[model samples]
Target: MATSAATPHNKIIGQRELVVIVALLMSLNALAIDAMLPALGQMAAELNVQDGNRRQLVVAVYLLANGLGCLLPGSLADRFGRRPVLFVSLAAYAACSLLIAAIHSFEVLLALRGIQGVLCAGLMVVPTAIIRDQYEGDKMARLMSLVSAVFITVPVIAPSLGQGVLLFAGWRWIFILFAVVAAVTGLWVWLRLPETLHPENRQRVELPVVLRNMRTGLLNRGAIGYVLGAGLLVGAVFGYVNSAQQLLGEHFGVGEWFPLVFGGTAAMMAVSNIVNSRIVERFGARRVSHAGVLTFIVVSAAQVWAAHYRPGELAVFLPLMATNLMLLGFLGANFGSIAMQPFARIAGAASSVQTFCRMFGAAVVGLLIGQAYDGSARPFAHALLMCSVSALVLVLFSEKGRLFRRLNPPRQQQPAGPPPV
Candidate 1:
């Protein structure tokens, strides 16, 4: 568990290769979700979905499955080793993508998409455990921010990519692309990526032990508080993502330009993440996260006010929404890294727990916001404002009401104590 010892274990991949692989693996989740944004209407029309609200299910179901299914990968990775678990999950993900393309039934597509989402959970959990395997505290935050900066490119390009594919090809071709990407990535990983989970660190595959570790992670105030807090904060992003196509196309009448608007917002997030990777090392995760959340709250509040007065205007709405998302990039990576600080010894299960909490919580928030679509941006903006305030409260409570304080420094052995209740 020494940072000194972890250095060598992590060095095999080298920094640049490690970043690239981790970014791609992590982006699988984003790519799968975002790439289908432009085609949601087309998909629904082709599939004969008359209710507009139900169309968002194409996005929501995947997230729901992702949250529920993430429960397995961490425990399995801790037991089996990262490489094998990853390969299996990636193969399943690829298979699902391939299979979904040929299936025409909407109900069946959702079911298969759920299965694919579950498979994608492995893509989500293992890389974090591997990163936790290498770094801790602020350094881990920095690395995660960088990974996110790289990973955000998927969101930036995926909708546009989806739009591009839809130009000459049917929507089902999107899944074909997913199949191709997953297969190629699976091969690349199998051939190039070595197992990062060390033999000495492997845990016995036992349900009771997994539950106990998850309980411990939940009971730890810093971990659980941030888990809930960051999860709620992340819910704002998911809410926007789920409703983005409609909010742009229906409310703002951007229609075919929805991908461009969405991509531009995502690009801002990428820039902020790049900046976050640089500044988090110096400011510490706590200070940066605290400031970031406050910024998120202010932006959310302003968005609500702006949407109230300029509700129908595209010019005003897009910039504020983009700014809010850009600021969110600073919060997500650091919050997760901070939450994982207490779980070095059990990063697999801990990562699973965190992913579950974040994704499920986000799913609930997103579903509500998406369902509340009233042909205006107010519902989304109001949801953002509410989630931002809720997140700030949970984060404040997690820190025992002390903002901008770092309780654990990078590479330091964590002191044992009960967290603030």
Candidate 2:
């Protein structure tokens, strides 16, 4: 409820409009990956990709590139402006997507995918930085939740879109679709998005200064904890993503219907995001995130146990997987807001470092899980359980064992002297 007028330094545009645009921007990352799921096999076949495992490179490489790209453009945005960086990056992303669609060799495809990831760095970091430019505390959390709520719809629809493209036009058309969407988004961003990083508030692009700020941000106890926790949470989600199709199609025999099933579960997470948006202001981000993480831990552990006993039961598997993903919707927005809370002066750098850690962590975890794919769901379940527990421990330690303490402190306890008297 802190009005923009109170902080002249931070100009608030239309919050609702900004949230929608940022959400669309963030959805691009998910769309890039999710929309390729149904086409992975076809892409591999068409490109004569030798290694079956290497086919995942199309997705993994993109994510790794995205993480690496986060390092520089964030600083550039702080120096230049958010809108310019964002528009340029989106255009580059569109070019990469088009290149990927037209490429015949796997090498070229991999390189294009990686470049796409790198270009998306602007899309990933700038919108969050812009939100930080204008809002903080619960307001930031609320806006992020709204953004997440909007983004949740991407996963729900992307797979279906991919499948439709595959059914009609073939897999290359998937990348073409990505290119078209990126082009449209780029134009919209150029025309509609204003410069969020004001001229007066711009920081000079000093390498030493950027490094120093990054170091400081990383060293902050709360920021580090939230970053690591967010990373672990995302890593688990990525692990699930890298393995979900195989688990469903090959193991459970879901076949071409896999996309519908996947999209349905994603809709469950979307519902969780909507709920988070409603209650985040009153219940507090820390409480919601901590609760969600714990719920994730519990569900993941149960999944491990159940999978051990009945490894092939889709009934046992799918529902638990959906629930865990829903929990992530609660964790994602809150973790970012929590990490950025203590670093206001250098919000851009803080956002960058935090994003870098999350993506890097997720890439590592996803790669590890991807390697463990042995035509069973056991490895994925095990990784999820381990990650959830690790994240829970980190969150608890980060908040000084007060992870769920009320954001609004309780009234002071009366002295015990009255009882003695």
Specify the highest-lDDT model's number: 1
lDDT for each residue of candidate 2 in 138-218, tens digit (9 for 90 to 100):
768888988988988998899999988877897878877877888888777666666766454466676777787777666
Supply the TM-score for candidate 2: 0.92
User: How well does candidate 1 match the true structure in TM-score terms?
Assistant: 0.94
Worst 10 residues of 1 by lDDT: 412-421
| Top candidate, metric TM-score | 1
| Counted clashes in each candidate structure | 0, 0
Q: What C-alpha lDDT, on a 0 to 100 scale, does residue 114 get in candidate 1?
A: 92
The RMSD (Cα, Å) of candidate 1 is: 3.7
Q: Per-residue lDDT tens digits of candidate 1, residues 1-421?
A: 2332323245355776788898999898899999999999889989899998899998999998988888889988877777887888888888998898898889999999898988789898899998998888899999999999999999999999999999999999999999899888887786767677766566766667778777765667777778888778777788888888878888889877888888998899899999999999888988998898898888888888978898889999888888888888888999899888877767888899888988888888888888888888888888888888888898878888889886655342321232111
